[model samples]
Target: MNWNDLERLFSPARLGRYSAARAGDTTKAALDYTYNLQLSEAMMPMLNVLEIALRNGIHTRLSALYGREDWWETWVADTNFNWQNKEVAYAKAKLNRRHEPQTPDKIIAELTFGFWSSLFNTQFQHVLWKDLRLVFTRCPKHQRKRHNISSALNQIRDLRNRVFHHEPLLWLTPTLIQQHSVGVMVINWLEPDLAVWLNTQDRLPTKWAEWNITSD
Candidate 1:
């Protein structure tokens, strides 16, 4: 339909960025919103793979470091990174509330992306990073500083939040390309072959090249 139709369907406030950007061209705004929606949909596969890969990679490394599969059983008591204790406790508590077993894998799944990404923050560098950093198997030897990975993950997490919350990505398309690139880069660092496989499923990059929405 037209701007009025789009406004009614998506709510005018939601579509306002598109309308305002295109000189009140509601048609283009609707189209932009639709494009963002499609790109957001296309982004999921890569993100899903990345999230799983990251969590598994970390779990594996931590388990090995502690010499046990359920290292988190004593993680807070034994590890110096006490900062993450509450996050881990929260994850376990949520699982208990749902009547789910607090298994290691279950707890890992329950932990937020924020928790995983936070491990890379410099505050944890002194404690967690010493051992956890080894999880990035394919990360370049010289370029594997905590800060670099932390920055990339923080940006990717921002995009993840935006996408999950149904925020407009059209306005952030240019920077989003970099953010997604860093996401895949993180995946590559953890699993090179998996990262290569991910390219086959990722579609947003190709669509971005075709639409070049940043210009309009």
Candidate 2:
């Protein structure tokens, strides 16, 4: 929420410079490196959490549309989560065994890209288009496009990469926050549908408004 937090995140080097300038001690350089490393490490699980939420959210939307309770459980069940199994395939496919056993840098890269894009070269654009068509029958190209959802997904993917690659991330900018907001927008777009679905199950979130789109 704080702009300084973002600055400390996406561009920690800038903050390091300021700190080094303020502190004439030679140890300030080491302090800056330590700070940068800590921030990058922290970003890993934070971005992972966002990615997990994204996958869960997407599946929730799809399940609501199709009423496939079994499929929903299968997608998330701990036993079936294999990122590398041969049976696993596609955007919603299970994670590889290697990912589960030991998350490698390469696995992180694959996850960062695979979650947003189709695994089998399927035209995902049509999926977004379908959602848009359902919501807005006819509108300007700008309005017709799933801007919020697309933007949010892209931001999540991008942040995932930055985190996986050990890039500095402490201070976030307004633009970065806006990117996270895209996920919020996607959730908002599907809220009514989700509400109807949840009502049937009597599991409505009591304080949905408290949910801000964050990696955490």
Candidate 3:
């Protein structure tokens, strides 16, 4: 079908970008929409690995630092962790609503990726970076600074949000590829063998190379 028909079915709001980007060429626009789906699909494995690994890394380190797996309880009560007060409350409230026990594992799984990434914020470096920074076991001593890991987590967080939201990512294939690598790089620092396994599950590298070559 043509752009007019596709737009009608999919809603102009949703297809407008593809239509404009393709200069009203229905075939090109459709192809681009399809490509976005394929790319986003290929992105899931990488994003999943990044989020899980980062969250678990934080949970493990913090649990040890505070001497409890349920460290959220401790942090929530401490005035120093004020930035996270609401998020911690929300996780607890939600668990209460769902009838799930506020276990450490459940709380970690419930926290948003934004919460995990925000732990790397510069403001918390003095209080948390010294300990949380140890999560990157394989990272070089010099390169294990807070800012470096924070920047990588922020990049991965942004890319993960975009891909999960179904945003178009083919326009900047090379740059997108570079951004996604931040996740892989962080994973490598955490566990080299896990990073190797991540590559096995990841289709992004191959898919991006193929699409970038043929995408006009």
Candidate 4:
């Protein structure tokens, strides 16, 4: 596509007002490279931590609740809990169609981040506060509220969606940093060792230091 056509396809307006301010000077190629780099350096690590914490946290709680690793089927069968049934249905379908038998761990690993994040919705408040509270036992005693966890998950989910869709992130540095903190906190809450490992794995700080971002 020509420059104008490319600009129309990846509109600066959709990237937010800050990006629009630099639209005149920034080329599409530069914007694409910057966003891809930002995702790899900043967003991906946070998303990795968040996804791991979420699945493991919920899995641990559910296992304890049902006294089995295969607690997902039991939980899905509970009519009282307001889970997104379609996700469960999809999982079941996949398992059924698989050539080999699939275990709960395999199924859980295959589930999407959306499925895990949905568990924090208000409909599952009972599960969050009563059944899953122990999952976050490492969280600060005062900040162990389910709502706080839910809020953090929601923010991280939004950031994830933005990054995956190639949306602008340079304008949301502060927000991204906050969400990254939330991801780390949740990871620490779920598994201290995992959190420590993540600290070493994370490269966002180094990437940010190297970028030296400036207005085009």
Prediction 4 global C-alpha lDDT:
0.70
For residue 70, model 2's alpha carbon misses the true position, in angstroms, by: 8.6
- Pick out the ten consecutive residues of candidate 2 with the lowest summed lDDT: 203-212
Q: Residue 195's C-alpha lDDT in candidate 2?
A: 29
- Model 4 residue 147 CA deviation (Å) reads 0.7
Tell me which of candidates 1 and 4 scores higher on TM-score: 1
lDDT of 4 by residue, 100-166 (tens): 3677777787777888777777777866568777878888889987788788777778877887886
lDDT by residue (tens digit), candidate 3, 54-170: 899988899999898887777766777776878878888999999999887888888898899888998888889998988998998899999999888887888888888878787
TM-score of 3: 0.92
Alpha-carbon lDDT, every model = 0.81, 0.43, 0.85, 0.70
Off by over 4 Å in 2: 1-26, 41-49, 64-113, 117-123, 128-145, 170-216
Best candidate, TM-score-wise?
Answer: 3
List TM-scores for all candidates, in order: 0.89, 0.41, 0.92, 0.79
In model 2, what is the error at residue 17, expressed in angstroms? Answer: 11
Q: Over the stretch 115-150, how does candidate 2's per-residue lDDT look in tens digits? A: 433321224455434543343222334644555345
lDDT of prediction 1? 0.81
As a whole number from 0 to 100, the lDDT of residue 86 in candidate 3 is 84
- Write the residue-wise lDDT of candidate 1 on 33-84 in tens digits: 7778887998897789988988888888888877887776666675555657
Candidate 4 or 1, higher lDDT? 1
